[model samples]
Target chain A: MRADYLILGNSAAGVSAAEAIRATDSCGSIVIASPEPHRVYGRPLISYLLEGKTSLERIGYKNADFYERLNIEPFLGPGYDAMRLDANAHRATFSNGTEIEYGRCLIATGSIPFTPPIEGLDEAQNVTPFLTLDNALKAQELADRARAAAHAEGRESRAIVIGAGLIGLKAAEAISHSVDRVMVLELAPRILPAVLDAEGARLLQGMLARHGIECRPGVSAQKILVDGGTAHGALLTDGTEEPCDFIVAAVGVRPNTAFAVEAGATQGRGLVCGPDLQTSLPDVYAAGDVVQVRDALDGTERPLALWPNAVRQGMIAGRHMADDPLAPVFDGSFAVNAVDFFEASLLTAGLINPPDNAEGVTCDVRIDEAAGTYAKFVVRDGKLAGYILLNRPDNAGIYTWLIEHETQLDTIDPALFDSAPLNCDFDKTMRWERLHAGYPADRNEKGFLVKRECPSAS
Target chain B: MKRIYAIEAWCLGCKRCEIACKTQHSATRDTVKALTQEQPSPTSRVQVEGDRFLSLAVNCRHCAQPKCVKGCISGAMQKDPASGLVTSDPAKCVGCRTCVSMCPFGCVQVVSVEGRDIALKCDLCTEDGCIPGEPACVAACPNGALVYWESEE
Candidate 1:
């Protein structure tokens, strides 16, 4: 089989790239393949499903006729996943032993959970990594059974979630709806260490306690206590045992780049790609959680495993591969993440925790624990480096826009940290230009705002 | 495609657009009733910024490359290819507020109704057949501060 464009994943990056290609090359033969059996659905919404916030029907990113409207053929299911890539020969081999010749291809296989080596975890039952839809479904089923067993025996049914990262905590919160007790164990001293600082994590810990979920930091499972092939408890490294019925191992995720590496794609941290998002190979491009791009702020190469970055890279890759010579290149990305647990919401972007007392780096922060609000602004030189806002979502994007544009401090209001930002918060000229013309009208290919002489100033 | 643009010169910061926007999306669809009687009062998607001397009513630009659509984790936010209109489904939002954080214009808003949070944004005032093909915010502007028209670009 031969295809003009063959995409390897069906999640955010793959679907975005397909849309970009279909936008211009309407008649090209496009084929998308995935390891998952289900149609294209929001991968992040799987946790919301367990929490009863979303249903299967609503989780779909597009309408029912998405595939039909685009006129693309899809090879989906467990065996259809890309098994090997012969980049030199322009052929990709699938697990089902089928090879397809492609004019151009995309590697958006995303990432899988990197489960840590815990003694006897491989032989234990009801042990799964929280990454795929199947894992979420299995977790829901296990929670139901644990709930029933706890009622029958008149004891507390417990679930221990390893790795207090974003996925681990979301899994704990989602399963708490069905199970009686959920305990999160983390090797790090603070929860959500990657996104939140120690102060914010401490606040989140107190908030999670209200939902009856306990968090044990500075501890991890030394061994999985199995009884009759089922995980009954977890033996902690601190010489303590926590009784549990189900376990979610969500330690971390690594780029699924083995297939591309076997095909001799140059990799560092992840499958290295150019500014145009193309690999070293002639026609192959890499994107999503599987490729490393330069970090805009720190100027380091790392996989920005976030949804927005994946979507942006996909569009850049699609346009570049679809014969658009002047297409926009992949601008470096900084994190903009929002995680909510029940009523509490936290938004963090860029460098949340910078080096202590770095030259020309200053931090401004405000915390009102009574109202559960925390706002921190980390400024480097004259630009907005990063910020963390908790329980405040109003006009939060203004700060993000500033960070993206690297707006100077002279124009920014000092009161912005205490109140919701408004268009008036900016200088009069900027307020008029943005509200009148809209964005991307004046933005250059690299996403910087091109300054123009203000139209006679308001 | 027609888009709503704010004329900062004429905006008086009267906020009539805000009131009209809320009433149009409200359950009662009446200005007085929706404002006074509706519990958890409906929020206007358009925002009035600045003072009477210089102000603008900021609405969703619905850009060609919408960052909100790209950042939406639940796949709830989408842009209509035919009309270039960007909107989000409330049923699938899950209230993560990722869209709210990513939209540079700060037009997307989140409202909590009966303990469940969902995203609320300007759908061009096209939802529920309100004013057929017109925008209530643009229509209610007394000073002609708002205009809905196609650009020559």
Candidate 2:
């Protein structure tokens, strides 16, 4: 097979790159290959699927006719394995003995769930790793069985979820309604330790407790207690045992960069890409969770495994591949997390909790423990560095924009923290310029006059 | 791409734009009846901000790169490539409010309908039987503070 652009892993990044390619090079042949048989779907909705909040048909991120409308070919299913990149020949070979020549290629294999070496895990049944649609389906089936068995025995079912990160908490939240009790065990001292501070985690833990989900931080699962070849419980490191019928390991994920590394592409935590998302090898690019991007807040490189970053990186890579002159430069990437758990909304962006010894960094925190609302801002040199909004997150994007643009706080109104930041927060002249500049003149037929206000002369 | 532009200097702060937007989006489409109806009450998507002398009517910009579209978990909030309009499908919405937190303009609103919350944003009065260039708020603005026009790219 031959194509002008070949993309691996037909998920968010791969599909985005294909769309971007089609936008610039209309007639270029684009092919997307993936081990998953289904078309591109929302990976984040898998948790919603387990909770029965959504159906498989509705989980698709793009429309069914997306590929057809974009005029891109798809090579889906598990037939393709072991992608080997030949930089010299500008081609790639699959384990099934098929080869495809490409003018440019993108590696967006995403990430795989990392299962720790817990004793008796391989021999345990009813244990699933929460990721992908297939894993969700399997977990749902096992949960249903456990529920029915509990109902038959006139009792309630229990489930144990390992890890307390975003994935683990989401899994616990999804299945909480179905199961009688869901225990979330985390080795870290607090839940969402990567993104949330200790106080933030404590607030969230209180909310989870009210909803009947037990969160045990600083605890590890030593072994999966299997009875009759079926997993029934977990032995904790604290000399305790948690009884359960099902277990979901949401510990963490590692980038799938083995193929790229084998092909001589440099790797840090993930495949190292230049500012253009190109790897060391010519004509080979990487995006999504498999690639490391520079952090905008701090001048450091890290694997930002967020969906929006993946889409943006893929678009930039695609534009570069197409040689589009107007291609937007990849500046930097940061983390943005939004989650709604049990009616409590939370949003966190950039560095929520900077290190204690960080120079010239200060923090302003507002905590309303009774109302379960917490707002904190980490500022450095009068610039908005990071923020965490809990419960009342209205206009949270303003903080995100401030952080992303590195806008100096002194330039804006001092009352920004007092209320929700709105467009009115800026000076009237700046606001007018931002709202009206480049806007087209209104047609006289609409009974309105189009007038351009000159801010410079005023 | 056609978009609604706000003239802050000309806004009267009368909030007529808000009433017009709410009435246009209502099920009745009649000013008096729509305001009186108890079931499925309409919520205005456009907001009037600032004081009397300096105020602006703000609504969804329908951005080219909408963060709400990216953060939407259910894939309900979508930006139409052809029309350049970002809209939400209520049938597919799970009322997560990810869009509410993600909109840079703070335009997306979460309204409770029959005890279930769903996101509401300016649809350019597309559902109100208005033409492409005649949004209800634009037509209702007597001061010519709001205008809808197509911009040449």
Candidate 3:
């Protein structure tokens, strides 16, 4: 088989690129294949699905008629998982023993869960990685069993989750809804070490405590204790024995880069791609969590593994694939995320923690213990480097914009940091250019907006 | 295509546009009931920032590359390819507020209604009391502060 544009992985990156391609080359004969047995759903909202905040259907990232209306053919389910890539041949081999030659290809096969070794972990029952839709289904079944056990045995069932990062805690929160108890174990000194600072994590920990979700930092599961083929409990490294009905292996994730790397895409922390999002291999591009982007803050290249970055990269790669001339350069990325646990919301961006003994870096924090609000900003070399806004939602992105633009501190108002930023905070000229005078939403010839999906509009 | 442009110099900051916006989007579409009776009182999509002394009414720019649309995790936010209008579907939004943090102009917001949290943003008065092509804010603006027009804007 052959396709003009062959896309692997149908999540954020691949789907975005397909939309972009459809917008540019209306009759490109696009082909998308993924291992998942469903349409493109929001991977970030899988926890929300477990929590009953969203449903299976509503979690879909696009309309039900998305693939149909767009005129792209999709090959879904485990049979379609790409097994090998021959970049030189411009061909890909799938698990179902089929090979497809393509004019151009995009490998967006995202991340894979990385589970740390634990004694007797494989013997444990009801252990699952919370990554894909299928895993969520398994967790939902686990939640149901625990709920049944709560009703029958009269002893509460607990969950032992390993890790205190974003994914682990979210899984804990979702499991907490049905399960009687959830205990999160993290090896770091504070929860959410990747996104929040010490104080911000402390504030978030307090919030989690109120929800009856116990978080144990500086600890990890040393062994998975099994009783008659089922997970009975876990033994912590700190010599604490805890009982549990299930275990969640939520350690972390590594990029799924085996195919790309073996096919000679130039490997680093992730697949190395340039501003056009194309790997060194000719006509082969990569995006989403599987690729690394240059850090806008520290100038280090690392996998951002964020949704917005994937979507943006996908658009750029699609434009490059379709030859959309006005595609914007991939300007690199910083750590920007917004997540909610129960009623608490956390917003973080850029370099939350400066390196040790870093010169010309200043950290400023304002705390209101009573309100459970903590706002910290890190500045380096007289430019906005990063910020953490805990329980402060108003105009948080303006700080993100400042970090992205590397705005000089002297030009900004001192009072702006004291409160919610407004458009008036900027001088008239800047305000007019950035705020009042909005970008024309439909000027097709401008920028990467030249996707040809709406042929009638053009 | 027509779009709303803020004329800051002609601004009175009277907040009439804000009130008009809230009423237009409210369930009752009546100023008194919309403010006092609604379970979750509608917020003004068009905000008059600063004060009467010096302020600018800010709303969604509906940018060509809308960060909210791109950053939305649940696919709740969408930009219509035909109309060029960026709108939020309250049903699909998980109230993650990712879009709220992605809007550089500070336009998108989260509001609670009927015991559910969803994103709230300006839909150019499409759902409520839209006056032909003009949005409620522009039609209700006392001055020419907010203009909804076309031809090189």
Candidate 4:
């Protein structure tokens, strides 16, 4: 198959790229290939399904006619086993025994959940990695069975989730309502060690505990205790055995960059991309969870595996591929995490906790444990390096905007942190500009803000 | 695409725009009835924000790149392609307040009716066969503080 644009993977990034391409170049033939049969759906909503907060029908990110509306051909089912890219010919050959010639191509295969090499884990039937929709469905079925068994035995259904990261916590939260008990195991000293500081983690752990979810920090699962080819529990490093009928392994995710690496794309944690999201190979681009871009907080290049970043990168990749004059230059990417755990909403942006030894790194923390509110601001050289807002997360966009724009902290009104940052918090000139300026009108000629077309206008 | 623009200097802070917006969005079109109805008070999407010197009637800017829509997980919040209007579908909204947190302008709010919560924002008064060009808030502005018109690029 020959097309003007060939996109691999059909999740957030791939769908976004295809939609972006269709926006500028309506005549171009865009083909999206994915192993999943269904059209694009929000991956994060899978947990909501387990929690019964949302139904499968409402989980779809786009409407049923999304692909039809965009007029993009979809090649679904059968994962792309192999990819051979001919840089000179601008052609890609997939393992499905098909060759496609394209003007531009994008790789947005996203990531796969990492399951640790725990003894008996691979052989256990009840252990599943909670990442994809299939995994969620399978886990849900297992949970149902476990619940039924527990009911019949007049006992509580216990579930073990390894890793206290975002996914694990979400999984635990989702199944907590359905199961009798949920235990979260983490190797780190605190929960959400990557995103939350020690204080922030402690607050979240307390909230989790209040909701009856057990959190074991600084403990690792030594082995999955299996009986008759089924996982019944796990042996912890601390020599404790927890009974669990179902287990969810959500340690972390590694970029699915085997195709790009095989195609000679240089990778460091993820496929390395230029400012335009182009890979080392000609006519090849990478975005979403599979690409490493410059971090806005620090200068280091790394993979920012977040939904907003993926969508932004994908849109940029599409614009670049289509040769749109308005193609946005990726100024830099940073990590932003927003989640709700037991009615406590948390928003973390940029570097939550910079190393104590790092020069000029200062932190301002406010903790109201009784009210379940914690706000921490990490700053360096009069600029906001990062912030973590718990419970009172109103108007977090202002802080995120400041961090993204690298606005000097001194320039902003001090009253911002006191209350949720509002239009009144900004200087008069900035307030006027933000209020009057049309979307994207305030963006500069280049860098991050550029090429961010209004979803409607595009 | 036409959008509501705030003329900060002209705003009298009479809060008439807020009242008009609430009535238009309420179940009843009557201003007195909407405000006085028992349980689930009417909400005004437009706000007169400022002290004495300068007050701007602020509503949804209907951003070109709406962070609210992007942050919305339930796909409840959407920017209409043809109209360039950002609106929220209350039925689909899970009231996660993700949009409320992400909206830079602080336009999206979580409004509770009885015990159920839904995201309430300016929908440009498009419901119930309201005229396309006429928004209740913009029309009720006595001064030329708020205007709904197409901006020249």
Candidate 5:
């Protein structure tokens, strides 16, 4: 069968491109072939799985009936990697050895967890990397069984979490609540070194500590030594041996750009794409964690692995692939992480004082020893720049809006935050007023202005 | 009798309805105070289901053919004569989860405060006249997905 567009990868970019194509060209056949066996599920739920906060069935982006409802065929399983694009014939090959021609194709293979080279890492048993839902469920099983056994025997179930990135921190929090102890080890000098500033990481680290998770910054896992077909613990670079029942490697992910590279497409950190997310190969596009995007803050191109960014990027890529002629809206959106750790929350977006420039507003707020929260607004030239919120983020939507819309600080009163929380009654009214400025509701239609759910309410 | 309706399209899947319902029905007024207080535990009439992609904020339709009122053995659960709202009396509620079992939409919740059980649902925040007057969830919704409508309309 011949299709107008053959999309590779599934999660964010692939499904989005399919939807975009449908929105514009209804007749063209769009096939999304994914390596994953299950439906597209949110990656963040991997940690939540450990706590049994949500089940695998609930974590999926769509149910089995979603594909049929959307009028898209999801070619599931391992045949995804076998999708061979032949630009010469304008066709793709499936592992079943079936050849399908395409007018255009998109590569959104996404990324994989980067497992650093360590001694005895490959042979180690019960050493899971938090990536797919399957791995998350496996990790949960291990944690739950270990916790039960430890409680029965009156022993502490220690779980060694390697890497202090977002995933690592989340894993630590999930396990810390159920396990005897959770120790987070990071190779970098500070937690979230790439994203948050020193102060922000410190505040988060302190918050995690209070939650009973021991965080070890500036430390590296030298080796994953196992015992009795199970992960016992790890030897740190600092010459300390920590005892543990299992290990979770949250070292981050690398874009799966082998096919793109094999096709002789322009490659940077990942598959390089133009402003339209089109790769060097004609009619071929890419987006999500797999495709490298230019930073909106600074022109330096990098891969954005966050879920929201991926979804938006995929939509843009998909629209363009389907030949939407709109002059293009929204910036080449950068990566943003709005993470909720236990009771505390963190929102990091754009460049927060890049090393080259040291000129941005720095704001801090520490609630107390147990409840420490901080806010930093990285402003450049009086316009709303990057901002980070740690520990009990309130009205993050307002700050996020300011950053996204590039709203100038002069238009609003900065003192509003001083009187009440970010989502204060006054600020909420102001926000609502700004959002629905031209068209205001005349009367209370039996309830609120509209039938919408608030973020916290969700 | 005024009725409440949840428009699924506008729902962002926030459980503020549940939270507000529990808070208003609690012994104390404050959120923290409500958490610790015992008896007459608050329960929401609404239930938020679905995924991040497409969510459905579900609640009782105040059905024309109500099954819950018939399922109630102790006569505690009844359709209020004045408002047509599903009201429950804790004093008579026997802690039976029959309401929960009978609810096709799973809108009715039986909450335990200390020990005794009480039935809860959306009573239309008629008492608290905060911010003029509105249901707590409706007032709290950022997306404006839920609202009350007149039964006659």
Candidate 6:
């Protein structure tokens, strides 16, 4: 098939690209290829699937006729796989021996779970990874099976979740509600090592403990021991064999950019895409997890696999590919993950890493272990550099806006942070200023006077 | 050229004007059945005051650039071609509530009564059969709160 714009991958990045293309060029011929069997489903809601809070049908991001309404051809597949991107020919070859030609193409292939090799890992039957909807369903099945087995035998069930990252912790929480015991094993010194600092992680560890899930830090699974063709237990690096009914691998993921490499697009940490998401080839572009774009804050190029970034990048790339270029909406992508784990909300933005030379920088932090609230702010050059708000997140929105808008310290009273809600009501003028920023017209139009109308005026 | 006017002052808290609006718009031609029947009572396009204690009537202002009509996703809300009044067809509305959320004045109320979502607001009761020169609200108001007048040059 030939089209004006050919898009690969059908999740956030791919679908957003399709919408952007249609918005820019209404009549352009578009062909989208997806490896997944169904419509785009919100990835964030996949976690809620474990608790039976939602069903597969409720999770669809777009409706059934979304593609039809957009006037785009959807090569949605259970089998349609993109094997190679022939950039020179402006075509892609699928594993099923189907070739699609395009005017311009985008690679939003997203990412796949990076399951590291452990001893006897292949023999495990119920080993599941929490990445796709299928994986979530399969993990739920295994969890239910283990629970049923325990109930039948009048015994307690155990579920081992490897990697105490976002996915691992969430999965462990979900399983803990149904199973007898859920243990989260993390190799890092602290849980949520990448996103949260030591103090933040400690707070989260306590929260998880309250939820009845065992949070183990600085412990690595050395091997998975199978007995009778089933995963019997796992051996920790510390020489401990913990008996478990099922194992969930939520270690992490790497960008799926093999197609980019095969297509001869310049590859480094990921497919090297310009600010426009364009690859080395003329008509080819890469986005989402598979492409490395410069970070706006530090200028360091990183693979941003976050769903929000992917959607923004894909939309920008799609509009550019449609021959209607707007000012590149996404220069690179900001890194922000707002997650709620077992009712404890966590919002982390920017790099948590402080500069090596912290001599001149001033950091203010307040930690309330009892309330499970942790707030930290780094002020560099009189501007907010990084922020971390956990549990008690009422001020999260204000802090996030400050970080995004680069609000200076001069405008804010240092005492405003003292209030639990971050309200500036203590200072009338400051409160008015903050409220005016949110609604400019109300103050500007009305001023400090009320107009009086006579009864006959109506 | 009768102008739709809302009385901000001397307005009673009762929603009789809203009821009168539904009575005028209902195809049933009977007020008792329309008011008492549980199944799909005719919805007045008018909304009672959002702030309950200090009550006021909220209706479309019929602005030059009506935001409710502009914000409608399914093209259900539209300005009358000749009358220049912002109106919505219940048939075309998919009940997305985008208009309700977007309206700055909180003039639109999206109520899910009888298991179907619909927007309620005031349409001046223009289509409701009227006598030669009087609006239903102006006549119904015991305190003479609502007034209808034409703009004079």
Question: What is the C-alpha DockQ of each candidate?
Answer: 0.50, 0.49, 0.51, 0.38, 0.04, 0.04
Off by over 4 Å in 5: A94-99, A145-154, A227-230, A327-330, A353-357, A360-371, A419-433, A437-458, B1-153
lDDT of 6 by residue, A75-134 (tens): 878656789888888889887888999899998888888888888666788889888888
Per-candidate chain B TM: 0.93, 0.93, 0.92, 0.93, 0.78, 0.75
Cα RMSDs, all models: 4.7, 3.7, 5.2, 5.7, 12.7, 10.1
Tell the DockQ for candidate 3: 0.51
* Interface RMSD after interface superposition, model 1: 5.5
Model 1, C-alpha of A45: deviation from truth (Å): 0.8
Q: How high is the DockQ of candidate 4?
A: 0.38
lDDT tens digits, residue span B27-70, model 3: 99999999999978888889899876777789888887788899
Candidate 4: which stretches are off by over 4 Å? A79-99, A438-458, B52-54, B112-117, B128-133
Candidate 2 per-residue lDDT over residues A2-88, each given as its tens digit: 999989888878888888899899999998988888888878778877766567887887888999999989888887654788888
Q: Candidate 2: list runs displaced more than 4 Å.
A: A441-458, B114-116, B128-133
TM-score of chain A of each: 0.94, 0.94, 0.94, 0.93, 0.86, 0.91
lDDT of 2 at A423: 80
Q: Is candidate 3 or candidate 6 better by DockQ?
A: 3
Q: Show how many residue pairs clash in every candidate, following the order shown.
A: 0, 0, 4, 1, 13, 4
Error of 5 at A422 (Å): 6.5
**Candidate 5 residue lDDT tens string, A186-225:** 9888998777888888888887888788889999789878
